[model samples]
Target: MNSRGFSRRDLLKAASSGFGYLAFAGLSSMAAGAGSKASPLAPKAPHFPARARRVIFLCMNGAPSHVDTFDYKPELSTADGKTSNRPGRIPGAKLMGSPWKFRQHGQSGLWASELFPEVAAHADELCVIRSMHTDLPAHPEAYLMLHTGNSQFIRPSLGAWTLYGLGTESDDLPGFISIKPTGRNGGAQNYGSAFLPAACQATRIGSEGQPIADSQIGNIRNTKLDAAAQRLQLDLVQSMNHDLLKRERVNPGVEGVIESYELAFRMQGKLPGVMELAGESPATKHLYGLDDPTTADFGRQCLLARRFVEAGVRFVELTHGDWDQHRGLKAGHSRNARAVDRPIAGLLTDLRTRGLLDDTLVIWGGEFGRTPHGQNADGRDHNNKGFSLWLAGGGVKPGITHGQTDDLGYEAVEDPMHIHDLHATVIHLLGLDHERLTYRYAGRDMRLTDVKGVVHKAILA
Candidate 1:
C-alpha cells in the first residue's frame, strides 16, 4: 500500500466491482480452508494402499441400450418380434434385436457390436459389467442416483466426496472438473458439495452441447486491473474475508471465497493455455479424432480431459448426451457411438502409454440401461433392471466380463450391481472406504453409499 501510494480501503473501493465474481466462484467451489490453516484442496494421503489416484467418468447421458452395445443377448435376437413376456409395464411391447453385428475383440474375445469398433479394439482392457441396475428409470432420479447415490435427498456428489477425501493434486486447477456438463436432470447438484465443505465442489468449464473452444469460466478475466493491480486488490479483499472469518468462528462461505480467490488468481493464466488445443501435435489430434467434424466436439472434450488430468486435477467428468435412442435407435446410437468410439479408444491408449491408466480409474456408462423390448418402430424404453457399464484400468481385472442379465437381457440374473455398489466400488478403487468416508450432517452421519453399499469385490484385480 505504501509503495503503491494506496491504502487497503482505497484499492478495495476501486476494485470492488471486479472482485464480485471471485466471491461467486468461492461460494460455488464450497472449498475447505475456512477455519483452518491448511487448504481443503490440499492433497492428502489415501486411507490405505490405493489402486487409483484419480477418476474420469465418461457419462453417457440418456440411457444406452445394453443389448445393442455390450450385453450380447443372442436369445433376444432369435426371439425378435415376440411379445415381451416379462412383466408389469409396456403390456404389448415386442422384443428388438440389435441391427449392428456383434463380434469378439482382442485376445479376451469379449463381444462388442459393430457400432463401437474402435472401442472394441481395446476389449482386453475393459471389465464389462453386464448386470447393472438402479432404483428408477426416470432420467432425473436415475441421473441423481448415479452421481450422488441418492435421488430423493440432497447429497454430495461422488466428485465432491472424492475431493473431500483425497483433495486435489493441482493448486493451479480445480480439484474436480465437469467438462461439457449438460447441467440438466440434476444440474449443479450433479457436482455440488451438498452438506460437504464448499471446497469439495467442482469447477465447471463448459456445459453440455456447448463447444469446448467457446467455453470459458465467466468473470475470470478482469479488464480493469492488470496482474499487479489485481494482486493488490485481491489481498485487501482477502484480508477483509479473513477478518470476517475470525469474527464468525466458522464461515464456510468466507473460506470458499478465500480459496476461490486464490485459485481464480492462479488459474487465470494457466487455464487459458490448457484450453488452447493448438499446442497439441497433429498426430495427437488425429488420434483423438479431432480432425473430423463428427468427432471434433467430443474429441476436444476428451483431449481436455487428458490435459486436465495430466495437470493433476483430481476428478474430470466427460458428458456425451443423446444416448436415449428411444425411437431411431439405429441412427441415433450409431452416430453417438461413431463420434466417441475412436476418441475413447485413443484416450485409453494415451493413458496406457503415459502410465496413467494404471492408477487412473476410467469409467464409462450412462445413468442406466434401456429395455431389451422395443418401444415404437425402433425405440427402447427406460429399464432400471438390467444394464451394462465397463471399467478400465485402476486395478480392475482386465479382459473379464462380470455378472450377467437373464436370457432376454431384461433382468440382472447374476452378480447384479446396484448403483450403491457401483459407488462403493468406485470409492474403493480410489483407496477410500465407502463406509468410512462420511460427513456428519443434519444430525446423522451421511455417506455416499447412504447406508447401503457393498463393493463389488469380484471385479477388483
Candidate 2:
C-alpha cells in the first residue's frame, strides 16, 4: 500500500463483512496451488428436488421429416398427389406421403415409420412431442432459438445456463460437452457461453477420434520442480494478483481466470481414468455399432456420451450432420438414420442395464422438422410451425404420444409446445424454476425462457 500510496479502501468494498476476503483467499490458493477442489461444475443439490440429474441431447443437425419418421399421417397418403389449403409460404402445395409404411411397435402401439426400426423398438420408452414449434425457418436462427431461446444474436447456450443453475456433477470432466462431426452448421456458437463465465462453455470433442485437446500442463516436463516448489511459485503469483486486485475493483475477468486455472488443474489429474475405453467389453462396443464402418464414428461418440454422463457430467450433446435434405430425401435421410439409429437404441439399453436410465434424461430431435409438402420434387423445406421430438428416461412418461398436427400434418392442431416451453420443461425436470433462475445482463435479468415458457407437466412421469 505504501509503494502506491493506496489502501484497500481504493478498491470496491467487499460484498459481505469478511466473506469476500475469504473468497479471495480461496481463489488465491486455487490459482497457485494444485489439487484445488473448488470447481464450479462440481455437483451440488438443486434449488428443489430434481426428477432428472443428467441430460443427453442428441441433436440432428438438419431437420428430419416428422411425417416420415414418427408422425404417421394416414390422410397424407390419401392426399399425397393433391394440393393442400394449409397456411404456409407455399400455399396450395401438393401433399407428400412418406414412401415407407408405418406400423405399431412395442406394447405402446406407437406408430413408427420403417426409417427408424431401432428407435421404434424403444417406443414404450419414448414421450413423443409432435407439437414442437420455433420462431425461425433458417438454420442458424432456428438453432439459436432452440439452444438459447433467442434468434437475434449471441446468448448463453442452454448447456451454459444449466451449468450456471446447477453447477457440475463431476470435478474431473466438464459439466457440458458437445460431440460434433467435422463440418457442421452454427459452428461453436451453438455451444458457446456468450456472457456467462467461460467455465460454463461446452468442452467439444470431435467425432473423428480426437481428444478434446492435449490437457497436460504446458510445462509438465520442462521443470523438475516438485509439488512443494510448485506451491511456492503459485503463492508468489497469487500475492501479486491480490495486490493488484486491491488497487482495481470489480475484476471479473481476473477472478474468472483464477477459477479456470484451478478447475483445469483438478481435471488434469482425473481425466486419464475417464478416457480409457478399453475397459468396455467387446459386446458393448458392438451394441453401439462401433465395428460398422458407417456408424463407427458416431457410435463411438454416443458410447462416450453414455460414459461421460454415467460419470456424473450434467449434460452431453451429440450431433450427426448434413440433414439439410434439399433434394434426395430418401438417400439423405436413410444415411443419417443409419448413422444414429442402432447406436441410440444401444445407449438407452446400456443406461437401463446400469440402472442410470431413471435418473438420466435423453432427448433426440433437430432444431425443427421438415415440411410435409415437398419444396423440390423429392425433398421438404424447413417447417418451424410443427415438428416432432422424443424424450426418454428421467421422469418422462414413457410409451406415450403427447401432441398431434392437423390431418395434412401441416400445423400443430393440438397441445402446441413451443421451443421455450421445451426449455422450461427441461429446467423443471432438473429442479430449476425457469422464471426464477435468471442472470443480470445488459441492464436486464435474462433467463433461458426469456419472457415466455410453460412446462408441459402432462408429459412428466
Candidate 3:
C-alpha cells in the first residue's frame, strides 16, 4: 500500500504472480467484446447463388506446349522443317511440328494429342480453351500473372481473393492449401496473400520432391502437455494477448495471430484424420496409380487434393513440374506426362463417381505454352501469345472447345482470352462479380481483375 490505498501498479504486479487467474478472467471477457465469433474461416454465403463451392488447380508448373497437347495445327505440320516467314518469328527460325499424334475422342470428339492419352479419355468432360494468352513469355512473370493477375506488382493471389470474397467452409483446416509447391520462378508469391489478412495465405502441405504422404504439419503434437494442460496454457496466452489488444488500438495483424492460434489448436483434432490414407480402399489406391512408381508421387498429390476439396477446403492446388522443354521436347514431355496422366484421369473419375463434380471446379494448365517455332533441334521456345488450358466440372459446358489459335498456333487469332479474363470467369462461376469483389487498400479499390476482364459466358453451362 502506498499512501491511501494499494496502487494500480501494485495490483498489476500482484496479478502477474499467484493472482494470475483473476487477471485472466477479466481480460478474456474484455477481449471478447459482447458476443464474439469463434473463427475467421467460418463458412459465409457467396454474393449470389454459386455453381462451384470449391476449386482444385492442377498447376503444370513449367509451361506445357499447347501445339503438342490440345491445339492441332495441320498447317504447321505441313511447314515442318522449313520456315522463313511468320510475323513475330525470329528471321531465320524454323517451324517445328509436334511429333505426337492428335486424335478425336469421346462423344464430343475433342481433339487431343497422345501426350495426354489418359486425360483425353475424359474429353467429354473437358472444356478446352485453345486461345489462352498472357502478358509475358518468361516463367517468373508469366507465373505471377497467372496467379495474382499482375506480373509486376505485389498482389493477393487467386486463392486469397477467393477467401476474401467467400469465407471458407472448413474450420479445422486452412481454406487455401498448396501441395508440393515449387521454390523456383515466382515462388511463394504465387500463393501469397499480399495485402489481405495473413490467414488468407495458403498453408503449404509439401515441398518439391517430397511425397505428400510423408509431409507433416510442424509442431502439431504437444507430447509435453496433455489436452487439459495445453488448453490452460492456450487460454492464458490468449488472455494476455487480449489484454495487450485492449491496451493498444485494434491491429489486424494481432487479430490474425489470435485467429491462427485458435485454428492451430482446433486443427490438431481434425487434420490427421483427413491426411491419413490408411482408410482408403486398395482399389482406390490403385486407381490413383499409387501402386506404380512412375505415377505414385503425382498420384498421391491428386488423391490428397480430392480429399481436401471434398472436406470443404475452398481452394487446393497440386503442382507438377519441369514441363519447360527448351531441349529434348519429346523425351521430357513424355516423361512428365507419364508421371501425371493416370493420376489426373483417376482424380476426375473419382470426383465424378463421388458426385462432387457438380460443385467442384477442376482446372488444368501451366503458366504459358511453348512456341511452334523450333529452338534447338527438337524443342520449342516459350510462347505467351497463345496457349491452352482446360476446365472440367463446376458449371462449365462439358464436351466443348472455346476460342482458337491461328493456323500456325503462333497467336490467338480468334476470341483470345487473357489472364484477367480467365480470373474474372472463375470468380463469376463462383458467383462473385469480379467488379464488385473489391478490397480498399493503399488508396483505391483493388480487385483481382484490375481494370479489364470479361466473363467468357460462352463456356458457362
Candidate 4:
C-alpha cells in the first residue's frame, strides 16, 4: 500500500463500487440465459487419443479369495487338507481347496467358479489378470495402495490425477464420483485430492447404511431463495471471488472455491433428474435387479454409475464389500457374490447394449486377495503375494487371461503386475503417460505411479 500510494481502505472502497456494477452485469447475463463463465470442468483433449472416455471401478472392498474365485489351481484341490510350511504362513495353516467348483465358460473358455455364474456369462468380454501382487497384507495399507499408489504417504488418488490431467467432460456433475464408498480403512482419503486442486476430488454419493437415493450434495438446495434470487446471489459472490483472485495473483484454494460455487449453481437444475430412478423403465429396473430386495441396494448403485458415465462423468466407482471372509468363508463369500453378481452382469450387459462398453473401461477386484492356506479351519487370511482382477472393454484384449500364479495360487509366478503398474496402465488407457502426467508439489513433480510403474502393454488391444 505504501509503495503504490494506495491504502487498504481506498482499495476496498474502489472494489465495492466496481464490483457492484460487475455483479449487476453478471446477473443480467444470467437473465439473458448466458451460462456461467468458463467452467473448470470444461472438456479438454487428452495427452493423446484416448481409448476410454470413462472408467467404472467395481471395488470389491474386502479381499476376495483368488483360488476360490477365478484363479483355478488343480494342485491346490488335489492336495487339499495338506499342511503348508510356506513363508509368512500362520503357524499351522493348512492348504484348503475351494468349496465351490470352477467351470470353463464362454467362447473364450475362461475359468470361473459357480459362485459368479452371472459374471461368468460375460467372460468373453473380460481380460482377467491372474498375477496381481501388492505390498501389504492388511486392509488399510492395501486399500490405500490400490487407490493412491503409495500406501504409506497421503497423495492424490487415481481419480484426482485423471481429473487433473483431463478436466471433466460434465459441467453439471463431478468429474469423479465414488458411490457408496467405504467409511473405514482410510475413509475419504481413498478419494481425497491431496496436493491437487480441491475441485478434482471425488464427489461421494452414498456411504455405508445410507440409501443411495438419499445421497445429495450438502446445501445443494436453498430454502430462502428461488432460482433467480440464487443466481443474483451467486453472481455477486463470483464477482468478489474474481476480484480476490486478481489481487491474490494465484491461489488454488480460492480457485477451487470459485469452481465449486459455479458447479453447485449449475447442478441445481440438472442433478435431481440424473439421480432419479423412477424415470427408468421397468425393464431397466428389473435388469439391474432392483426388483429384488437382496440386490436392490447394489443394483441401484451400479445403475447410478452407468448413468453418471453416460452423463459424461470421467470416472465412477461403485463399492461393495465386507468380502474379508476370515470365518464362515463359504457362506460369507456366497452371500457377497450373489448380492453383486447379477447387478454387475446387468451393468456390463447394459453398457454393451447401449454401446457404452466400447469406450468405457470397467474394472473389478478387491484390495488384495485371500491366502490359499486356511486361516481358521475353513477361512483364509489376507495374501498380497497373489490375486486376480479383471477388466473389460476400453481397448483391452477380450477373453484373454494375462499373467499367472504358482501351483497353489499363493504367489505371482510369472509377469507379476504390481499396483503401481495397474495405475500406469489405467492412465495409459485414458491417453496419459504416467511418467509425464505429473504435478509440481513440494518442490518436485508428483505422479500417481510415483516413479514406479510400467504399463502392461501385452494386455492392450
Using lDDT, give the best candidate's number: 1
| Tens-digit lDDT track of model 3 for 324-371 | 999999999999999999999999999999999988999999999998
Candidate 3 clashing pairs? none
What are the C-alpha RMSDs, in order, of all predicted structures? 2.3, 7.2, 5.7, 6.0
| Tens-digit per-residue lDDT, 130-171, candidate 1 | 999999999999999999999998889999999999988876
Q: Candidate 2, clashing residue pairs?
A: 32-234, 41-168, 42-168, 43-168
TM-score per candidate: 0.95, 0.86, 0.92, 0.91
Please, what is the whole-model Cα lDDT of each candidate in the order they appear? 0.86, 0.76, 0.83, 0.83
Sorted by TM-score (best first), the order is: 1, 3, 4, 2
Name the 10 consecutive residues with the lowest summed lDDT in model 1. 24-33
Error of 3 at 81 (Å): 0.3
In candidate 2, stretches whose alpha carbon ends up further than 4 angstroms from where it belongs are 1-42, 89-92, 181-185, 207-249
- Screening candidate 1 with a backbone cut-off below 3 angstroms (N, C-alpha, C), the clashing residue pairs are 29-198, 30-198, 30-199, 31-198, 31-199, 32-199, 180-208, 181-208, 326-379
lDDT of 2: 0.76
Question: Which regions of candidate 3 fall more than 4 Å away from where they truly are?
Answer: 1-39, 247-249
lDDT per residue (tens digit) for residues 259-330 in model 4: 776677777677778888888899999999999988998999999988989998888888988899998899
Which 10-residue window of candidate 3 scores lowest in summed lDDT? 21-30
